[model samples]
Target: MTIHSRAKVHRMFELVEPIATVTFSDVPNEAFLAIGMRNYWDGYFAGRAAPLGMVPAEVVHAVFYNFADGEVARHIPWVWGKTTPAEAIAVRERGSALALRQLIGELADSAELAQVADLATRAGLSAPTEGRVLYAGLQALDVPEEPVAKLWHAATPLREHRGDGHNAALVANGIGGTEAHVLMALAAGMPAEKFGRIHHLPKAQLDGVVDGLRRRGLVDAAGGFTDTGRATKSRIESLTDELAAPPYDVLTPDELDQLIAGLEPIAAAVEAADH
Candidate 1:
């Protein structure tokens, strides 16, 4: 793909990711709680890992690649005990569909929404499965029959495919899970404390990661990116965009434009509801 096509592919997938991720909010957490999940993490881990079956925490940790150490272990096997993978999957789909309806009103069931779902589903499935663990797991499930649920389902694999590529990029650049969080926070100008809390990394450990990055000349003493750090981050993002481009190849330029146009309003609605 040309650079423009690659950027468009990245933009299209970015637009669709919220459809799947909005489930993490309170709107869907209610459904998960009803299903016997203990809390948000239980629902998040169980729902996402459901398609992989009753896998252990190590497997989840490996595939997820960015959570704090032992974070996946704190939730995985225990979550499976409270709720089966199949149940988790069912509730998440139902919950996400409900969220879409509430967020977007009648647009959730519109023909335009269906067309976007079909196009995204096509692109998501066209992605090669090799080395894409999370995407492959999502791909193995049957598509949902509900209109909004189907859209969320279609977005899941595409999100995971890009995520898996991002993990590969991080690994290639020698960035560890905690280190990745620190770098991202620095790069985005996010507050250290807020980003660290989100990743569940303790203060001491977060500092250690930052210190390590500094030793590697990737971070300055002021906690901003060094010139080398900026270059490395740019390269990782570029590689991630390139790796994520293949799925969009199935769409013609016009089809891709249509897909983005359809998703943009829905994503905006989702964001509005989230706030």
Candidate 2:
């Protein structure tokens, strides 16, 4: 199937997010408690154009303030004050190489995923454009300079940039975070109860968001989006694509197509892994 640049980018995210975020699920509790904090912090803090020294509270204010007021309490479950920001940075700086190295080994061992990587290599995406975009985001990071992850590093940075750009689109369109999440849930055909967990809103707060959406004619009483809501979500996605298009400008249409083709099987493989 033919895919647009935006769709290709979204597929790339499907391939990468699982890899980048598996630290939360795959690593042992002790290992995660020990080193995962750095991974989480760097992944979020990096590629942001905002100023440095943004504590978790400040991060909530800047990015998620549009959601419920007490979201920070519900959202961030990690122990605060357990690790200093400096120490977390230090850990990410020192440990990223090892973590990335191990991840590379893991990917290498997977013949299924290896085929995907090989396809990406054959698609003229092996080095320059992907690396360039990856490093561009790394340059924006508040962390001290360090060597790039060197393999599949592009995925994390690109995902981060996409997330930032998506947020910008939502803000520009006057969509609150809760409403945005609800819109997406409707698009995905998710049930209502899942909204509370997925969007970090209380059930009552989520109902409030739904009620507001209903009043706006975006959602019906049953929680599905109306036609206008679907159109609005499409526009939001289009705007996000426009904002995210800059880093990908260097890539030709053919290359983006190749990327989409190359990543589809890998994304499918990832999804089927637990089945």
Candidate 3:
């Protein structure tokens, strides 16, 4: 079956359309691992799963790993992490086969670099389940609550809680068990490092996921939410709530609440613009 049904697939391209672009680049491992994990989780275990077939597993994993690991991350380990894919008018970017850890240790003095290295290692070590195991680890961090903290709450003001319920449902019940945790993390607003810390994963994995979101134009880091961001966030909340509803409820109250918290303001903004 499709990992993401046509209807569900539209969310990334549709709701996030404003920011959506034909060629948005993926995030550095530092950024994507956070967001990529959830997407992988949802796509795999959701009602519309795209289970891997008999093809070489590395092929699919490479699609995800390479897509999420953009140019910025390549600098960390030119030969392995991001560099191997870079075609110089030649193949020289693949400098050496040095362990990723060795390069990471070189930048230990830089906090940001260190965090990013940690993200890379986590992503590298992760299984090809859209890197879910690493994602769970990254999302477990504690962070300061932002204004639109929960996706589900974002809809309450618009009386769109039912829609919110749906999104939760897709992630929790509609999706499988392992992936649900990563989806919960994104809805909760856990960024890279913090997300990694809580989940006990490398921050890079979280970065990869976020980067994936950004590449799809589903998200942006520019100060506030775009119309598309608001809409998608709202839909995610609605969907989450839908998924969380009884009979086939998947997410817990806390999970649903986080989605609402992140989406509510965006919903409010959308409604305001319409009027």
**Model 2 poorest 10 in a row by lDDT:** 45-54
Give, for candidate 3, the lowest lDDT window spanning 10 residues.
89-98
By TM-score, the better pick of 1 and 3 is 1
On lDDT, the stronger of 2 and 3 is 2
Highest lDDT model number:
1
The candidates, ranked best first by lDDT, are 1, 2, 3
lDDT of 1 by residue, 205-239 (tens): 87788889999999998988999998999999889
- TM-score list, all predictions: 0.95, 0.66, 0.24
Per-residue lDDT of model 3, residues 29-90, tens digit only: 22223323233222221110111222233433332321232322222222222222212101
| Off by more than 4 A, model 1 | 1-4, 196-200
What's the candidate order when arranged by decreasing TM-score?
A: 1, 2, 3
* Residue range with the least summed lDDT across 10 consecutive positions in model 1: 191-200
lDDT of 2 by residue, 1-275 (tens): 22345666566656656544433333322343474444443333321212233346545445533455654443243433344444543444434434443444445445544444443323322222332333343444443222223223344455555566777788777788767877878887896558544555567867888899889888987888889888888998988766555544445677666656655554454445534
**Positional deviation of 77 in candidate 3, in angstroms?**
33
lDDT (CA) for every model shown? 0.85, 0.52, 0.30
